[model samples]
Target chain A: MTQETITTDVVIIGAGPVGLFAVFELGLLDLKCHLVDILDKPGGQCAELYPEKPIYDIPGLPVVSGQELTERLMEQAAPFNPEYHYNEMVEELRKNEDGSFHLKTDGGLTFHAKAVVIAAGGGSFQPKKPPIPGIEAYEGKSVFYSVKRMEDFRGKNILISGGGDSALDWTINLEPIANSMQLIHRRDGFRAAPDSVNKMHALVEEQKMKFHLGQITELHGDNGQLTGVSVKGNDGEIFQVECDTLLPFFGLTMKLGPIANWGINLNENLIPVDTEKFVTDAEGIYAIGDINTYPGKLKLILSGFHEAALMAQAAKRYIDPEAKVTFQYTTSSTSLQKKLGVA
Target chain B: MHIVLVDGHGAEHKLEALEGWRVMEIIRDHGYPIVAECGGACACGTCQVEVDPNWAAKLHEPREDELDMLDENYGGEWSRLSCQILMSEELDGLRVRLAPISVKEAA
Candidate 1:
């Protein structure tokens, strides 16, 4: 309990590229930000979804890797000198009588800011877990939902579950290092990219590992030691496999935490927001990025950037309802002057 | 509900949480005197908690964030977040501990 209260002009919740861009946008508007995130670094889902995957349509670059794009956003946001609070989820958001906001975190820390931006990409940013019974009991024990490092799995028995590109990619990745591997999926079908699947198939042909097409029915272990798993295929075939660790790649995800109950009208899971107005059902709160839903808007990283920019302008208007839109340039003038070298 | 940390790394602190809640939720509900910042998103290392090492194999993959955080952490093998842990019948006598203090940096 340190009595020191940290304060900022705005708070950006997620650290994804769009969220990072929000921090940058707030800074461009001459506002300081406390860019809080759960990752030790920025770059939200991109870090997990596609670190090396190429991304087009990011404006400026013809092609960029996800990790590179995240780095760029972090650099752009660096100018604002935003304070960082990594490894903490915003436990609660409370507004004071005077209109200022109070921020609390899961880590027992409190922060104060003028405005809040819920930039969490695609709901809450945690890996989806397997539905097998007793799985939760061994989260920190032997079962895992993610692949942290390759070395950690060396000489260890590992089982990966998922039908998506992430699972396939991880399977191809850990093949060389892990002591033994089992790639399991509930459905006989796979959602992975053709190339990745092909590669995994090639690796499987090499007789280096194994693959099981079925959903995990149970994880059997004792005293925290995972011994094996039960897989029930669509054809009523039950197979039991032995393993020291289980990594289910079945992509389960969440969105909007407690804010979902704030009475905001969400189209599906995201809050439907007007691209131009950036208004949500809630009067004071505005949404941007993957959390925002609007007609004809395809959910993508590029779309999120657009949402973030529009929402920043709209939020400024909301905060100062009496102000009129001006066509004049605000802070870019200095940058332009610098570009022209006409000091 | 109580989060029993058997690892005994940090000052043993127990929290009163709702039953049927995720282990991370209880720790988080009690102000995360233990760290679960990602909300058990398995994305960061700050929530790292060592389970009763005897039962460590039951834990699953560290996920992207958990793995990333583990790579950047002090002790890799035993570090994990309580949020990723669920409290249920199987985990009745589960023992875990708050990760070391240094890992909380930027967590």
Candidate 2:
């Protein structure tokens, strides 16, 4: 299958608050932006980690939930018509000989852009791997963090772990197809939706599946194939549950995944950028938000907004050296106001 | 006062504690490996700690939000989000072992 390469003026690597605001800043300068994020939707950490948690530090808004802040930012950037590519992580970044940047995502989407913005806050939100010894050996084979296709597990003995919605939902969805299904959690109580929990319990009552209260301690298998798992029950009893597949949903955590291999200078996992332009050593490439570091840098949403504004000016100059960039206020500049759709 | 922190490797360090500061702050300030990713918001369970059973009852009960976050992190009975525990005069020398999940692996 042939994939078309998208060409744009600017490509923002993250769709978090900083990246969203970058769209507005670049938009004011008449620069079109295409944002790529690893999440299925926008609002990186805010939407993923703590959507309901209140953030008082955002300027002007004394109190706003994470999800609300993300929505407002998205709305503010809507006038720019910023295209967002979600659920795709940019795995490769290369500087083209022609001075433009070439980028490719894990999902096979490619882009050529005049400027690149790295606003990934704490890197990509990846599935948190449980601290199970020797579990890495069976990662892609018998042990899986996410189920891409439910049909693959059909007729296989499956053991699902975790008490969250993923665990309970998958336990119900896959029970009908699996040869045997067992749900193991650290506790009897679940954090999943009430209806999902009820459905899971009903399946258990009907003997459609088994529910074990314990944590997986060992994976018993070889050559990346699993035959069973040893569980340490809450009552201190150790038992083995025979299974051909293991799915663990332990929630998500931020990791500086592919970014570390992008050949940029990193200071303890954070990109170091100039305070003025928020630009890394790489020409036409910028890093902002919590993923960047500079003298007196504060990892706050407000600070990232300031970075995005300055970065846009630098990016505009880089994209077109002869273009004159005049500083103007949104409240007074009609051109800026027109770009914001309020003129 | 001081709080004792047991690292993942079983090494212990006694660190100074200040009033009104979360236990996560104390551990992080002392240069331990705790991530405390959300900056003491009690949202990310990366600052989890296994409180010594003897002193677990002395700390204030885990609130609903804290418990919910812990549940996502596979927390147990003695497990608590260090960000939720505030340093207090009543609990002078609290002891908490850093949960394995909370340790920031060397990058």
Candidate 3:
């Protein structure tokens, strides 16, 4: 170990809503925060999954798309000019006897601060692909789990597999450029949002690509070049379809890493926390967002906002002891210290 | 119709499902905040919950994408994403515990 150390008023891990909000609150208190996240970008879960999906219960608006929500969050917290380090995964968290925290990442970077917040949304969400027989043979040749540069897919034969909105939406998005596109589902009916389904209907009628109700059973190719595939449909019939590329948008599962082994009580996979305070048992550490568990914890963007705002205030108190929070989220300054007796 | 006991809002809902609906939609339709990211399309693991240990026998083991989602959720053998299990009346009364996650965590 090289033995490096840093100092700050607050050290926030996982730059999700809670972490971002802490910067705002810290700014109001005239304090500084160092934010670290595993992702290359901010907006946490909103940016990662369903960037185009609409979110309900954000307080003012009945609905906002995930991507748009992320944009707004970044804007609101931007005024604080919070510091951040991206593409870094936190591997360890340690606290000193004087009530300070130390953070280390897999990339050999370390951070030191007075307090830490765990805002990693239900861990990290990434795309998942089905295990088609012989599929591994096509890796990097013609199969992909996520969309990498938007320009890469132009003018190619593509087949998208999934019933959820993303799989369907991609079908609609890629229709114009793809030499031809096809949507395949295990079921005849789709469960995607109505708007996306409608778009697909228009594309299907226009003969843009097509839809097949079934699963991809096998991948066929010679010399690492994809030729076609075998499908099992709703009618229990197997058929061959010719295509050059295969895309499976089956979606990803939530993952929490070693934190699950830190001796925290978990109800299934979610870490248990105080319903009112959102504090984990580890003392001086807290978890907010989708990874936390409590009674009636609605998994909504607005809910995360509430949890983040409140937790930020509490973490301030944990560190400052003398800091005052008005409206709970007001972090402008210690200007209210004598007025409040929290210390 | 198949029956599945879902863990929701800290309480398990003994949900009854139609033949075609995914388990994620079943919990959501019953008014639970399952927050099926990717809308239960399995693109995200926000709908994760632990399978009822005894009922695991009846349910098909989650495939790679589903297992990967579990791994992302700090998955253990007992953990599963509800979206991966479709409803079948045969699963009626199966027991499960909802994973401790907020909609934000799943996102």
* lDDT digits (tens) for residues A1-343 of candidate 1: 6657778777888888888887766665556778777666777777755577677777889999879998888877776677878877887777777666787877777888767787877656666554467787888778777766778788778888776777889888988898987887654455678798888888878988887766678889998789998878757788899999887765533435666554557664677777786667655466777777778876577787777777777767666667664433435577523333432
Q: DockQ of every model listed?
A: 0.02, 0.57, 0.11
User: Candidate 2 chain A — worst ten consecutive residues by lDDT sum?
Assistant: A185-194
Each prediction's TM-score versus the true structure: 0.54, 0.97, 0.56
Top-scoring candidate (lDDT) = 2
lDDT value, residue B15 of candidate 3? 68
**Models sorted by DockQ, best on top:** 2, 3, 1
Docking class of 3: incorrect
Error of model 1, residue A248, in angstroms = 4.7
lDDT of 1 at A236: 73
Clash total of candidate 2: 0
Which prediction has the highest DockQ against the true structure?
Answer: 2
Off by over 4 Å in 1: A1-3, A131-216, A220-228, A231-256, A317-327, A330-332, A335-343, B1-107
TM-score of 2: 0.97
Clashes in model 2: which pairs?
Answer: none
DockQ of 3: 0.11
